[model samples]
Target: MRFRRLRAIALKELLQIWRDPRSLMIALLMPFTQMFLLGYGVTLDLKHIPVCTFDREASQNSQSLLKHFEASSYFAIARNVRTYPELISAIDRSDCKIAIVVPPDFSERLNDTGTSSVQAILDATDDNTANIAYGYAVAIVSGYSNDVALDALGRQGGELQQIQPVAVQSRVWFNEDLDSRNFIIPGLVAVIMALVGAQLTSLTISREWERGTMELLVSTPVTPSEVMVGKLAPYLALGWIDASFCLIIATLWFGVPFRGTLFTLFATTTLFLTVVLGIGYLLSVLIRSQIGASQVALLLTMLPTTLLSGYVFPIDQMPTIIQDITYLVYSRYYVTIIKAIFLKGAGIAALAVPILFLLVYAAAVMTLAARAFRKRLD
Candidate 1:
C-alpha cells in the first residue's frame, strides 16, 4: 500500500538483477536466441520433395507426364528408374519420397477409352508428408489429363464447352500467401512472453532467501502486498520489452503480418504476463531454492504452451480428450487471441471471450500469489 516502500524494494530488486550475471543473461539473451531458433527452425511447409520415376512406355505421352512433375515447385525428379527394384531402392535409401510409374498402355487407354491411370508409390514413414505429396501428385496428374482431353476434343473438331466441368473460384484471406510464418510468429510471441516472464520472476523471492536476506526482508515494515508488487513490477515491464522485441523481429525481420491495433496487443499481452508472472512469483514464494523454482516455472510455462496450445499442431486433430484438456491450459486462450489479432485484425470487442478468461485467470493467480508471500521465514 505504501508507494515509497514499494519503490525502494523495486529499486533494490532491479539493482540485484543488474549484479547477477546469470539473471542478466537470461533476461537479455534468452529472448533473442528463442525468437530466431524457433522462428526459422520450426515449420510445416514442405518444398522440393524428391521424386523417382519409371516410364514403362518410354513414349512421348509418358515423357510429358514426367515433365509435369519436374516443372512443379513442390517436386524434384531425382532419378529415372529402369525397374521396380530401382524405385524401391531409391525409397529405401531415402533418396526420394515419391515414385511415379507411367503405364505401358497409358496413351492407348486414353485414346481408346478416354481414361487412363498412372501408378503413384509413396514412402509413408512420415504420413503427413506423404499425404501432402500425394495430393500434389494428384493435382498435377489431373491437370495433365484435362490438357490431354482438350487436345483430343480439338482433334475431333468438338467445342471445349461440351466436355468442360464447373470451375471452382477459391479465395484466401488473412495469410493470403499461406505462409506459416505469418501465424507462427504471433504464436512465438505469446510463448516468449509466458516463458521469459515466468522464468525471470521465478527467481525473485527465491533469490532473496538464497542470499541470506530473508531475515532483513522479514524485519522491514513493508506489507506482503507491497513486497509482491515491487518484486514483480520490474518483470512486468521486462515482459513488455520482451514482447516488443518479439513483435519487431516477427514483423520486420521475419515479415509476419500485423493486422491488429497496438491497444489490442498490449491489453492482451499484459493480462497474459500477469498470469505467468503470478505463477512464477507463487512458485518462488513456496519453493525456497532458486534453482528448483526456476525449473518448475520453466516446466509449467513451456510444456503446456508448446504442446496443448495448438502451437505446432491442430487442436481439432488431437484426440477428443486432449482437445478438452487444452481448454485448461491458459496459453491456449492467449494463442487463439494472438493469432486472431495478428491475422484477422481482431479487436477487444471481437476477442471478448478469451480476454475475459485471461482477466479472470489473472485475478485468480494474483490472489493466490499475493496471499502466498508472507514475511515469516517459516
Candidate 2:
C-alpha cells in the first residue's frame, strides 16, 4: 500500500514539473549564464590602461622616462597633450584614465640631484582601476631607478649603498593563481541548487493542494509522511542533475580545478538539496494557494542564500550578530565546503564541521516540516 502511494505521488510531481517550461528554463540555464557573465565581468586582473602624457621639458631624461611607460604592458600612451587642459579634458571625456605630467626642469633636476619627482594623476572614480594604475606607475619608476643606479655604480666603480631590504612572501591557499572563475563557479553551484530545490519542490506540493487532489490522496490509506517522501524523490533526482550540470560546465568549459573527490562533492550536495526540498515542502504545507507557496519559497530561498550565504560577500566581514545568524543558513557552510574542496583540495576531515552542521540542519528542518505538514492535514 505504501509503495503504491509513494509511486503515485512521485509520478504526479514529475508530471507537474515537466508541464512548466518557464521554471525549467530558470533551473537549467540561469546557473550557466550567471557564472560565465560574472566570471568574465567582475575579474580583478588589470590590463591595457589608456594614458595621456604632457612632457614640458622634452629632454633625454623625460623621453627616457616616457619610454619606460611604453615598455610596460600596463600602460599605452594613448595621447600626447601640449597643455594640462588637454590632459584634463581627455580624462574627463574618458579618453584616458591616467595622466603623467613631466615638468620643464625634469632633466635638469635629475642630472643635478640623484632624486627627482614627477606628478602622477590617476582617475580615482573607479577604485580598482585606479589601484592597478598606481601599482603600475610605481613599478615602472622603480625599474628605471634601479637601472640608473646600476649604470652609475659601473661608471664610478665604487661600493653600492645597500638600502633597507626585506623579502615579502605570499601564498594564496585555495587558489594559488587567484583565478576568479574557480571562486565564482563554486559559488554559483550553491545559489542554483538553492533556487531549484526550493522553487520546484514548493510549487509541486502546493499545486496538488490548490487543485484539490491532495484531499483525494489524504482520503486513501497513504500517510502524509509517505506522500511527502514520494513528492521529494523525483525533485531530488532533478536537483542532482542541476548539480551535475554545474560541475561539468565549471570544470570542462571554464577550466576550473576539481581538486576534491567527486564522491565528496556529490554526497554533500545530496544532503544540501534534501534540506532545501524539505523546507519547500514545509512552506507548501503552510500556504494554501500555489501562488502564495511559490512566492514564499522564492523569497525565502533567494535572498537569504544570496546575501547571507557568504558566496559573494565574506561572512567574517558582516556584523557579529549576522555572523551568528549565519549558523542557521546551510548555504553559508556549503559555500565554505565547495570553495575549500574545489580550490584548496580539502578532504572529508577538513570539511567535517560543515558536513556536521548541514546534517543537523537537514534533520531539524525535515522533522519540523513533517510535523507542520501533518498538522495541516489534520
Pairs clashing in candidate 2?
A: none
lDDT of each: 0.90, 0.82
Q: Once superposed on the true structure, which residue ranges of model 1 sit more than 4 Å away at CA?
A: 162-164
lDDT of 2: 0.82
Q: How many collisions between residues are there in candidate 1? A: 0
lDDT of 1 by residue, 149-172 (tens): 888878888665667479898999
TM-score, structure 2 vs. true: 0.87
| Reference-based TM-score of each model | 0.96, 0.87
lDDT tens digits by residue: candidate 2, 274-312: 898988888888886778887898888877888899887
**Where's the lowest-lDDT run of ten residues in candidate 1?**
156-165
Task: Point out where model 2 deviates above 4 Å.
Answer: 59-78, 158-164, 375-378
Predicted model with the maximum lDDT: 1
